[model samples]
Target: MSFRDRTHAGRELALRLVERAGSGHLIDVLVLALPPGGVPVAAEVAGALHAPLDVLVAGEISTPVRPETAIGALVADDPPLYDRRSLAMMHLSEDRLGDVVVGERNELHRREYLYRGRRPLPSVNGRTVVLVDDGLTTGLTATAALRFLRRHGPTRLVLAIPVGNARTLSSLRDECDALVCLQQPPSLHAVGEWYEDFAPVSDTQVADTLHAFHATA
Candidate 1:
């Protein structure tokens, strides 16, 4: 079924996730969204679980030749950066690794400034963190987010999304403690294809959603 919008997708995905989670016991659990697409969906998930919502700043490094193809990803303030092997396995070019890194870093900085302002990042140490997104296609951003979460010492890391491609889902299975996705289409096109309304989420929308969720919590 095609989602009416990101908000509709979020509600549906959150219901499925809550069912899969098998309980509504997310007492201290945190929902970390990979913006700017992930924010709306993550807000719904956080609301459903009655959990605190946080933002995980990251960006995808798309291949120069194939802009739709993700070369790699970069997570802000994370150590033990992803290696070339990871990129190569994804069919990314090692020759353009430097360029990819530089571009991704610049985007990451802009995203961080736009979404975070002067607010400090939340602590995920020894807590159950539900990393959320609107959908997963290449899984590059999800991988980077998982790696960053690991470094921050989350007791359990769950990667959650509304929709995902089969290959991307398969690749991410072993990366996180658990994977919760609503749809996994075999012949995936783009992340926006499955939804009826897949508008590009803005930084202001993300901030407003975060604040609204926090206020209600």
Candidate 2:
């Protein structure tokens, strides 16, 4: 299965959500997207559900030795959440990741500012929170976002992605109240592989999505 674009995938996922929500799946939900890719998808979802849309900035921390591989994830202002498996594989430790964490944290904060401006993060307390991402591979960023959001006391924590690796989808099922994934291909590597037009999403695109959401909200 493949998507024409993020907008198309979002529309498809929104239909699934509507069906699921009718069967006691989602209620009083607040859509929180992992930008810059998730914004367009979540925008469609928020429009369909008539829910408020916001961003939960999450980023991967890559090691200097292997810049392409993510060793951990950075969410909010909390300490970076290390992928223990990845750490052990690279013969690394938490303390050794300090520099990488610092860099990723700075980058994540810069994005948070760029996307949301001076507006504070919306409250997820006592509400059903839907965490939307374009897709998942390692799921490290999703885990970090989930962990960080857990501190806010949401009534229910949901993971809603259009597609993901089969293994990752299996492991993540137990991590949240509901996991709404449209496709879980058994042999997957990158999220872009499942999309026909997986062009890079720019920072301006993300900001515009949020601006559009708030304009009619």
Candidate 3:
């Protein structure tokens, strides 16, 4: 199944989530999206559940030579999550990735500040947090974010995505309390392949989405 766009995917995904929660009441649920792609999808979920929307700043640490290839990901105030399998295949070690970690860390903090203004981060203690992403690919970023949030002691953690690679979902679903994925394609291709309008989400778009959701919530 192909989604029209992130918003359309968001609406469809929200319906499943609402049904899962029963009666559409999610008072303890906090919706956190991994920006900038996750923001648009998350806006719809936040609207549906009447939950506060926020950004969880995490970044992919691209490989040294092939910048498009992610070797790992870094979440806020946490050590970079290196893909052991990828690192072994590349014959790379954590020591050789100092520069990549530094760069992604800088970017991660920048996005955190840019997405969130003066408002303090919402307390996650004892809350059922639903982390949203537009799509799941390598799963490194989502894993890192989940690990990072673990320190905050959330009552339960859920990973929600519009579409994902089937292989990745199998592994990730077990990591979170629950996983809400609309599609897990068997043929395993790029996340964008599942969407008809998989356009790049801009910084302004991320900010606007959060602003719009927060205004209503």
Candidate 4:
């Protein structure tokens, strides 16, 4: 399945979550989006579930050699979550990525502060937390977000995306209580390929989205 854009994919994803909500699968729901891409998609979901929306800033760590590849990820003030296998294959160690991690972490904090301002991350404890992203590739960023949310004592943790690779999605089952994806194709080269209008989301867009949500909320 393909989408017109993140908003379109989000609408489709929202329908399924609405079904789950109707069946009593979701309760005391709280939607946390991985900005800035996840913000638009998650707005649809928070609307459908009538839940409060928030942002969970996570960053991907990669080397200059192959910056497209995510060797690890991080969320908030937590330690970096690295893929040991990937590190071994790349012949690199955590120490080797220190500068990269520092840069990513700094950017992550900047986005978090921009999107949230003085507001602390909403209490996920005892709430059904739905972690939303536009799509999953290697799933490194989502995995990091999920692990951080898990440690926060959420009653039930869920990871939701519009599209992803079937194999990668299956491997992330243990990260959350429920995993929702609209399409899991045999092979997904990249997330943008599935979207007709895969535009770059800016920091201003992210802040505006959060501001709009908070205005009425």
Candidate 5:
């Protein structure tokens, strides 16, 4: 199925998620978005539920030889951890692991500053935290985000994405408390291919969205 845009996809996904979420007397049910692509979709979800929204910054560690290939990702303010088996399967060198981690951490820091300002990360302790992203492809970014959030002691972690590859969704099932995803195409090409309006979300838009949320809060 094709989406008109990310907002359309998010609303549809949110409807499905709300049904599964059930009637709850809950606390700190924050929606954490992975910027800058996830921010737009996450905003719609947050508005739909009247829940607080925040950003979780992470950066993909690209393969040195094939720059487009994401070996893994590093979550902001979190210790570097990698899937040793995946690295071995990819035939990545142990010597390059440090460089990859350092480079990804630096990029993650840059993204953190770009997407978030002085505002502190929302406390998810004993709270149901819904993590939203536009789409999941390789799952590196989502995995990193989950690892970081686990440290924050959330009661539950619900990962919501508009669309995802089947393999990627399956990989995340064990990592998250709940998974809310719409379409899972057999031959997943790219996340942009599923949406009609697949424009890149800008950092300025992310900051503006956060500022608007803060003003209203």
Candidate 6:
């Protein structure tokens, strides 16, 4: 199934989570989005669940040749998570990606600071943390974000996405308490293929989304 856009996909995703919440699967919920693509999608979720919306900046590491590829992902100051198979196939090593990691890490920090000024990440201990993203391709970034959240002592961690690759979604099942994916095609060539409007989300859009949420919250 294709989505009209991120907003439409978000509303649809929220319906599934609301069912989970109704079943008592969610408690003391806190919605954390992986910006900037995840912001608008998550805004709908945070509103539906009456949960606070926030951002958890995670950066994708890729080589200059294939910039769209995600060889690894990093969150906060934690160690980067790499796809070993992908690395081996590409004949690349973590050491070789040092410069890429540094660049992505810097961008991650810049995004975090831009979306959230001096404010620190909200506490996840004993709370049900829902990490929202637009969609998952390799799922490296979501995996990295989930691992980072896992260390923070959350009571339950959930990963929600509108669409993703079936195999990739299955691989991430162990990372969170629950996984909500609307469309899991046999093979996902590109995430944009499943969305009618897959435009790049700007930094200004991310900032404005958070600002609007906080204003009401």
* Between candidates 4 and 5, the TM-score winner: 4
Instruction: Encode model 2's per-residue lDDT on 73-144: one tens digit a residue.
Output: 889888887888889999999988787788888898899999888999999999999999999998889988
* lDDT order of candidates, top first: 6, 4, 2, 3, 5, 1
Model 6 agreement with the true structure over 1-217: per-residue lDDT tens digits: 7999999999999999999999999999999999988998999999999999999999988889889788889999999999998899999999999988899899889888999999899999999999999998889999999999999999999999999999999999999999999999989989899999999999999999999988988
TM-score of 4: 0.97
- What is the per-residue lDDT of model 4 for residues 60-167, given as tens digits with 9 covering 90 to 100? 898888887888999998999898999999999999889888998899888888889989999999999999999988888898899899998999998999998899
What are the runs in model 4 whose C-alpha is more than 4 Å off?
none
User: What is the C-alpha lDDT profile of model 1 across 1-217, one tens digit per residue?
Assistant: 7788888888987897677557743436899998888898888888887788879988766655667666567788553244466566666555647766776788778777777677777899988899999888777778888987888888888998888998879988888888888888986778899888898998899888877776776
Evaluated against the true structure, the overall lDDT of model 3 is 0.86
The C-alpha lDDT values of all candidates are: 0.80, 0.90, 0.86, 0.92, 0.81, 0.94
Minimum summed lDDT over a 10-residue window in model 3 is located at 19-28
Candidate 3: count the clashes. Answer: 0
- Between prediction 2 and prediction 3, which has the larger lDDT? 2
Candidate 5: tens digits of C-alpha lDDT, residues 120-181 = 78788889899999998888789889978988899989999988999878988988888888
- Model 3 error, position 57 (Å): 1.0
Off by over 4 Å in 5: 25-27, 81-86
Candidate 6 has a TM-score of: 0.97
Which whole-number lDDT from 0 to 100 does residue 31 have in model 4? 96
Error of 5 at 134 (Å): 0.8
Per-residue lDDT value at 6 in model 3: 94
Q: Any runs in candidate 2 off by more than 4 Å, and if so which?
A: none
Q: Estimate candidate 2's alpha-carbon lDDT, on a 0 to 1 scale.
A: 0.90
Query: How displaced is residue 191 in candidate 3, in Å?
Result: 0.7
Q: Indicate the TM-score of model 3.
A: 0.94
Please provide the root mean square deviation of candidate 5 (C-alpha atoms, Å). 2.0
